[model samples]
Target: MSQSEQPWWRGAVLYQIYPRSYLDTNGDGIGDLSGITRKLDYIASLGVDGIWISPFFASPMKDFGYDVSDYCAVDPVFGTLEDFDQLLDRAHGYGLKVIIDQVYAHTSDAHAWFEESRQSRDNPRADWYVWQDPKADGTPPNNWQAVFGGAAWTWDARRQQYFMHNFLPEQPQLNVHNPEVQDALLATARFWLDRGVDGFRLDAINFAMHDRAFRDNPPWDPAGRTITRPFDLQRRVYNQSQPEVPEFLERVRRLTDEYGDRYTVAEVASDDPLPTMRAYTKGDERLTAAYSFDFLYASTLTAGRVRRSQGNWIGPLEEGWPSWEFSNHDAPRCVSRWYDGPDRPRFAKLMNALLLCLRGNPILYQGEELGLTQVDVPFEALQDPEAIANWPRTLGRDGARTPMPWEEAGPNAGFSSGKPWLPVGPDHPGLSVGVQEQDLDSVLNFTRKLLTVRRGSPALKWGELSFLDVPESLLAMTRTCEEESLTCLFNLGAEPVEIPEPVNLGGAVLSQSEGLIDREGRIMPPYAFVILRD
Candidate 1:
């Protein structure tokens, strides 16, 4: 398809808004749908093509909004369904697509389906959840471990069986293998589609299916690595990543196809995610795109890492599109994880440029454009259940989930009239949107310019990518459309690096470092990057 005729999501820049932290319009200290609507103009100013709002469904707040109780209802803390409709209409009015999260793998124990299923074995929805009988010795069903900790199977006395849970005990696994359960989930999706949602970001989709036989997962060799949780000690051979997952995905795609131009992207996190990511989005019958934790959890950013990530998606026509995210609500902010140098602002701009230059859709998390750093949330204030359970060992997701700073001076940085549900970062005030708006050289403005360039350039938006020969510290590649081509170069290291002799540095279209480029073979300073029309 030609660039203009392509789907709206192809190579789109999606801005992710974590509803709890984006902005709180009500005095509840938690952000709501109305808050997102209030900020639609600010989000539109960033030049993003769409917004991906994380789960705001009715939940018990055990895993935040992940443990959903009612699939169709909005949590009272957020707003009513009417509020969401207004947010959707306003977002569309700003020419931005709206993509909401769908947690299909499990639901809060308080859900009517789970509540009824656990009441008795002969209940109509008894088979809707994964319930297994105990072993001969009265031990739990299998060796599967929950993602949070301890045994995956939780004992329910009413049913006299151990029910499965992949995360917290409150979130029970749904037996997606059951045709009735699949039909119900599809109905929920259809409900949203009818309500005018442009797409869905399927959360932890690989965990939706499990091994029906309840076999033990083989022990995974740590290879001298210190294991944090028992869950990390197993290969997860049968707990998830079932062969039938693609079949279910085909059904999801078919449902989405009914809504013209609708999109679906799966979030797949595994020890080896490329294979599953490929499988989940391999063809037209599956998801439109899928993203992994490859870049999210990386300790460092390097040329080879970027090359391999990009190279994996370059393949035959049957291969599905990919989505890339450097930071999110779950992962620590990239500025804190990747670079600790004095010149963090420079590094942030370079990273932003690199993300937009990639071939796939680039997902920019809230506060990323402001160069936000991970906060050091204290033990007393930590809210993440996984982190609380494994304290001092893990860097808890609370640091990354802190409230976004909007003003330099405020009670909680103007994120709320009341104290935010999560603490705002100490340094976030200086990097607040109010502070960056006045400074033209700020990372926030630089990101806006870079996004504008990407939106206007066919090569950056819809081009095929090919790596160019360059030094170890530098990443060089070319993005080419039919008649347009642009060369992108990044200096990932602390020291200066020279471009190879064969490459042409051509006139700079967009650049980070001021005095680094020259007509002669150019040298890029620490964390510098440039894009040139070739």
Candidate 2:
């Protein structure tokens, strides 16, 4: 693809910033917009095209910023609207695009729309939220379960009906089936677009619409699953992934198109997100792209797993672009989750190289560049309701959402003057940004090199991807474009492996390493990776 014809978002690298844990200003012990603005240069140094700021909208913090109370206002804890404007301006000056989280699936129960909808039955917004009457036995309208736990339907004395909430009762599902509701959502999108946001990372978009009939979801066999909550007991057929979701996305596309060059990506969560992802992004009239929990929740990352995901969309003319992320605010750090012991550091760099080498847009979590490991938050220190509800079995998200370490040692590891909302682990001080920023051999530098290499190569940016049929534990893929053809390989294991003769590693090691290739065969260390030109 040529420069003129290339879409800004195609094969882009998005760095996700969980605003609450990124950095803190004003000694609030929590990260805020000003803190983000203070670190804009640090993020720009990472060579990412954009920053995806997780919800900073007004909220009660029931599910962090995911439960938005006001769509247009920035939460006081994050900063005022003026603060956001300053951040946006500073980011643009650094040639960075700003993408924000848009929680369209639901809203904080305290939202005026939901508040008014819960009043009288004849109100103008009475049907704005999903409200239903209880069954004959006064039980919930259906067997659908909330993602955080308990029944999806919450009993509300107001209007004498039960309101539906897919995650927490504090976040009631919006009745997107209503035309007025869709119009209101579009208005919110417009509010952000007009405020200078480049685009949005739609959170749980598959849950944006629900079955109009409010039908009971069927139970699924939990034979091989680790069922943590009641939600895992049923196949989420009726509650979400509705067929009408694509039509709604088309409307969103139209709204964004009017604003010019706006990008959209859907976060589809399900056992099988391929169908929804494919359908939602099947055409330009719908979403520009969509990503699921393919690598986020996986027990392992193997050759087959990578191949299957990349194979889902193949060649230069594939229907839609793909996006990938190894870890985020919601899941355990990939290095800690996939490997441990002395090999952890090696595995970290290996995975970073592998993720960047793949055929899709990549999302880098805030602390990931520094190879920050997950910090375990004790039961008493836990802030995530999902973790508090499920405890040890779930391995809660609190560990992953710990504050980013910016200094080797100080109050909150230089993250703040006050104590952080989440603990700054003892292990993180050494891996802090200040400590690694100057070290050429640090994971931070290595990751930056990988991103530099990716950005400089057209084949890596916009190329046709095809997996090589190779030996076990050895994953290899070829990326070809009009200008160049490249091969990428990885040793996703704990032991050394011998590379065969035909596995040609022509020249250069983007990731610094010793003894990468030999005449006999390249002896790969555990978690070793390399990129070569054809």
Candidate 3:
């Protein structure tokens, strides 16, 4: 099928499952592959098209499962290789495509590839990782800073040189500049593809390649932006966001294209990622789609931010497609971040409404259907590297990654029979799946209705988005496809505002929350959103 023919992933709602927190079946206090298999039916009932599982590969778990030690096998903590195979089969049986995480950016320090590369400068895999000589003063090769708050280079005694690591020190950066490294990474992708994965979610894809010259990064002025860590003090142009990334993506694309309909969505991290996103997905030969931290880490969700973030890329013809995600394992939940206090329930519903109605493909994180909020993980129990390293400064990801609450009354809310890796919050039990299942008007059911509405409407699934010039506080946009047009308006603030156009939760509406508009035809209360079809 052509790009315009609407492939399976085009505008698809992909549900992101963080396996370590999804469920625990083996009584190990950790979520495993079998637990995910058990919940396949519940996930399918959410009306999402596919499930994008986070890293479950064999890893040291330094950064959780992202630090891959073996690309082909599943980690013991998650489950065995057989468990993953069964999980894949069960997901496909539920009509859900399985997209596994492919970490091309780096490998664990314990990985065999890294072990050999670190042993000697002339080993078979010696040049597989980025290595450089230290300065005369015994300092790092350059001034490039790591994402987790330290110098980007770490000393390796065996190789007698420093190796680059964009994140944690345990996660050494791969030398993708080497053809051998690229080939090996591609082979890993092929391995998973051969194992029945529909596609791959390239983790930290922009970090796949870097300037090989060991160039120093320029400093950035903190006048207009908030600098959370020392890593944020530099422009990071030379350390990452290399021009060679797109070419590497094409190689990956050409490889996946051989598999017929295998999609790739790059996770871009940059100061200005919209342009990078456009460049990365400029053609079909590149990534199938790309998403950045536009709305994910934004302090406030405004109409202008939404418009610029969504409109930066031209139509799908000029630029490749874009994927939008409000909350993921990396960032805090939307209800806690975007939904202003007062009407929490209404706000959660409104947030989901806007997310599903966006122009790009929507990525809904697990437990978002139950209106899950961020849990306040104490500093003592912190797990993320960046979070632990920059505590009090960083709002660690542990809050968003806590175990998925299944029952309101069961032990640890039915997430595990034993104590979970992360403690369950007091507020999560009331928002558990079991609790939401009994309430017909719960956000869980409302999300199901919204998704059902989305699937049936061509205007929503494949439509061009144009922002309507209303108040800045109100996000008004129209999705048009031929004769069918759907107008979405949301009051993302506390003050009530007059409706730009007369709309109701009646006929013209596909789905909406009731009793929000005042008698004078004004959208009232915080977080009021409505959809009108014409």
Candidate 4:
């Protein structure tokens, strides 16, 4: 199918499920593929168009499932290959497209390719991974730093040389510069395509290629110079985002094209993402869509910030599509990050409207529909290695990975009768899906209503966006198409903000926690949003 004909990803709502923490079926305390197959109906009930399941491939679990030991096989912890087939069958039966995570940039050191590459310098697979020579002073070949901290190069005594790893030491970077390596990775993707996956969420795609010249990177010295994590210390110029990275992406796009309607969303993270996104998805032959961490790490969600961020990539959006996500497995949950007042419910509803109203594919993280708050996990209860290494300074991601709460009164919130790998928070029971499903004003119900609104309007899905006169804490915009035109307004602050008479609607289409009825035509209630249509 041609780009114009593909509708699977356009305006799609993707619900991300972290398979390890989603549900546990057996007494093993970990979520498996079988557990996910059983929950397909629950996920479908969210009104999302598709699902993006995190890595469940064979791995040693060093960095969870990101370190793939075998790209084609399912881990016993997740289930066998047959169990995955059953999952694809069931997800399709519910009319939900399934997109799985593809970690092609690197593989676990335990992988056969890496093992053979490290065995000797002249081996057939020696060039499979990035091998570097040390400088005369016995330093690393380049100044690149690992994302998990320390130098990016690790010395291997067997080969009498150093190899590069952008993430954990156990996860070695593949030399995507090699045509054979690229072909092998493409083959792995083809294996999954044949197995019936709709598409892929490419993990850390920018890290696939590195600077061939092995040049040192310039140092990054911010004014505050405070180090949140070791990875933030230096500017990652040579370590990733090579000019040749897009060529490989184009090749992957061609491979996906062979399997009609199979889309690819490159997960891009860099010191600068606007130009990188433009370069990666600049033409018709590259990835179908891509996403970056612009809003995921923001300290505030003000209207001005949102406009500026959106404005950065809107120009190059014609080159390819853009995917927007407020929260995911790697970042803190949106509800907890954006909340500051007593009216968290109102805050969640407002934010939900803001997210879905944006002009891109909006990815809703699991448990988000239930208004789940971030869990306060004690140091002893922490399971994330990154958190354990850098305690008290960095807030670990464990708080966001807690098991889903399905019932209000059952043990483990009905996630599992067995002990969960990650402890469920005591406060989660009240926010369980079972309890919220019946409530008319619950977050889940509001999510359904919002999705229904989104589905009913093409302007919210594929219309052109134009920003209006937005005040300090107010956001107003218009989305228009050939058939319909609509205006959206939101007051993001705690105090009510006034606006001029909106474009059309006699009254507000959707209001916030408080109503807006006034003689002056000003909207009432802080953090309230409304849609006006002609």
Candidate 5:
């Protein structure tokens, strides 16, 4: 199919906005729908096709916005439903699709459904959540551990039973296997679709269901990996990624299909996520795309790693499209995770070019275009539950969730007139949008140019990726679409490497590096990349 005839999201770029950190227009130190509306122009200027706003639903601030208290109401902190409508309208006005998050796996303990479910054993909503009776020994239903820490099942005195939670105790797991629960979740989707949302990013959909038998999760070997929490020691077979999860997704797909061209992407995170990701998006009956933790949590970015990750999705179209992200609200920034050198600007540009040239859709986190690195959030000010639970061992996600720095000089780098909920990175002022807007050579400007180039090229936007035979330190590939082709080369190592013979380097459409390229096969500088028209 031609690029113009393909689905709008097949190879489109999405910008992820963490609502709490994007911009706080209310001076309450938190970003709201109105704040996002105010920044629509800036996001549209990034050349991304859509904006994936993290949860701004009715949340109780536990686990931030991930724990939804009400599926159909906007949290008072994020303004009213009218504010979201205005934001969505403004985003569409700027030609940007707005995709909101749907946390179907669980809801805040404060949610009316969960509250009613936990009230009594015989309540009308007793079975609305995953409630189970304790064993004769008074232990949890089984050996399941929460993602944050401790036992996954928490005791409830009222019901005298235990409730399961994949992440936090305050966020109880929902009984999505129940048809009624599925109907309610689908109704929530219909509510947003009725509100004119372009799509939904399903949060941890793999954890929506559990083993009905409540079997014990098999033990997992650390295999030279650090053991942070008890949850890390289990293979996580029984607790999540159940066989029935995809069946629920089929219903979600059918509902979304009712709304034309509506996109649905699921966040599938587990020990082995590729298979589940594929299953969740295998055909038109499931999700449009799914992204895993392959690149999100990687400590290093290498040619072989990228090859393996991309190779999985390079088969037939029925295998489904994948979405790649180098940074997001859940993990540390990529530039800081992958590179630890003095010349971060050059490395940032190289990574940007590499991401945009990949085979599938690319999701860019806010402030990524400006080369923002992870901040160092102190323990006293730590806001993330996982970070506080596993402190001093993990770098924690708070660093990446810091507020975006808009101006060089401001109360909180222009993120808010008052103190930001999270501190802006100390070094982010130098990389602020105001600073980079004037510099043509800045990473921000380079990102704009790179995006424009990708959008204009059919091969780069909707192409088949084939890795070239190159050294381990180098990643060379070609994105071919019908008659158009482009060669993408990246030096993923510290030392320079030579470009092999027979690889075309004549038409250098875009290049980033401190080294030179010549006709006789020149040495590519450390972290350099070039995109050539073939």
Candidate 6:
């Protein structure tokens, strides 16, 4: 493809792989690098443009892989540096781009830089992290709190001061205000780019910079609260989404541009995410795309709700791009979250098809193709620190991060010969790849067909989205490019709906539920969708 022909991310589908739970090669109960290498063919068959691997760098696993010890090397638990090279080579061979996670906001306490900074306040590296003296009463510098639970600031006895840790105490937040620290992080990105990484999945990009004055955040009054997640109680204003974040983002953008076509997608989450996303991707030399938790947290599939969430793209996003995902390692599975009971399989198929037809790049979480639902983790069986800390009220993300189910009858669902870290979902065996591959009507096949349809039709990929004036229960829209026009009608309600006028297109190009044709017009089944050509 010529440079002009390739916009880098047009109509792309990025598959996310949570490294530790994807596959276990040695059966040490944890998934590793080589295990991911072995599954390259399977990923390629899904028609994804790239693979976004979550953090696999050296870490203490305090916040799972989000807490990095080494910015450049792969963790020994994952495999040697050689294994990453092999994985990269294999992924490229399959025509799949590799985007590794870049956790720039914080580092594991075990990191060399953190160790040096903690040794003494006057050390050369002491300013690398955010450190502050204690108040007269020996309390933390501010009312800031950690994202995991309480108090974002942690006191270091040696320095006789408190250091900012937005997450856990072991993961100290970096002082992006320091030019040296910014340069060091840029070097890390350059290292991966030099190693042939196509892009980066920036973890908590907005949190990289914080207000220096340590101001108190306003209180948030949530309609309800999760017992396990205290962070939800307070509105996180001062501690995150700092004003200086986009300034550093422009620098990261400049660094990525050195290697042509290298993309960066920021994982942005805040009460005001649309504004932050707009700021991050506003200019020409900034992030390629930004994703927030708008869709992931929503439990309703209503037309008005979906339209309000997705259709409301603010700022320069219309010129820029967006990355959307229904589920990831952090959130509960979409299928299980929205639809329960026997009809879940059908709903899951419909949801996949619906997502594929949307405007921006789509991301498929591992095992989403197989129609995997969230597994119920018991109190004793849970291994996620976040879940363990906030148990009863919050459904810890670990349930969605279980080992991939490859084979129905094989041991450990053929994920590994060794014991897996987390138990596979109970229905995983029936929903395994082996079983789904044989069943033509399976969710996996439905997803593949939907992707193929979208890939074949340029209208659905790069077209403009305009909402059609339809009933509240029906989501009606049209996607059109210069050459082609397609109309998509979805019945989000449980009861059947009938459109009074004839569809603009000749017939539906794809649908999960049955498409009904009547003298009045196209009769849509309950929760059915149709794609018509005008």
Each candidate structure's TM-score, on Cα atoms with residue i matched to residue i, is 0.98, 0.98, 0.97, 0.96, 0.98, 0.96
Candidate 4 minimal-lDDT segment of 10 residues:
510-519
- Local distance difference test scores for all models: 0.90, 0.87, 0.86, 0.83, 0.89, 0.83
Clashing pairs in 1: none
Please report how far candidate 4 places residue 479 from its true position, in Å.
1.4
* Model number with the top lDDT: 1
Candidate 6 residue lDDT tens string, 1-534: 232474657668889999888888887989999989999998988887889999999998887888899989999889988999999999999999999999989999999999999999899999999999988999888887777788888888899889999888999999998999999999988998999999998999888888888887888787764335667777778888888888899999989888888878999978788878877877577898888998787766688977876685522334567788989988999988887657777778778877887777788999888889899988788887778887765655988999999989988898878778888889998899999999888888878888878877776776778887777888888877776788888787787777646445465555545445342555677767777777
- Distance (Å) between predicted and true CA of 21, model 1? 0.7
Clashing pairs in 2: none
Per-residue accuracy of model 1 over 44-145 as CA lDDT, tens digit each: 999999999999999999999999999999999999999999999999999999999999999999999999999999989999999999999999988999
Candidates 3 and 4: which is better by TM-score? 3
Query: Model 6's lDDT to the true fold?
Result: 0.83
How high is the lDDT of residue 365 in model 5?
93
Q: By lDDT, highest first, what's the ranking?
A: 1, 5, 2, 3, 6, 4
What tens digits encode model 5's per-residue C-alpha lDDT throughout 1-534?
887688998889999999889888989998888888988888888898999999988888888989999999999888899999999899999999999999999999999998899889888888989989999999898999998899999999999999999999999999998999999999999999999999999999999999999999999999988788999999999888999999999999999888899889999898899889989998789999999999898989999999999888777778988899998999899999999999888888988888998888899999889999999899999999889989987646999999898899868888898888998899998899999999998999989989998888888877888989988999989998885888998989999888888677777665555466544656787888888887
User: Candidate 6 regions off by >4 Å?
Assistant: 1-4, 224-228, 314-319, 500-521
TM-score computed on alpha carbons, candidate 1: 0.98
Weakest ten-residue segment in model 5 by summed lDDT: 510-519
User: Which of 2 and 5 is ahead in lDDT?
Assistant: 5
Task: Estimate the overall C-alpha local distance difference test score of candidate 1.
Answer: 0.90
The digit string of per-residue lDDT tens for model 4 on 1-534 reads 233554767778889999988888886878889988999998888788899999999999988899999999999998899999999999999999999999978999999999899999999999999998788888888778887778899998998788999988999999999999999999999999999999999999999988888888887886665576657877888878888999898898898888887768888897688788777767778887789988887767888988876666444346667888888888778788877788777788888888888877889988888778888788988887777767765545888889989898878998888888788978789988889888889888888888878876777777778788757798877876766787887788889777766444364465344465342666556878887775
TM match of model 6 to true structure: 0.96
Alpha-carbon error at 216 in model 5, in Å? Answer: 0.4
Off by over 4 Å in 4: 1-6, 313-317, 502-514, 517-520
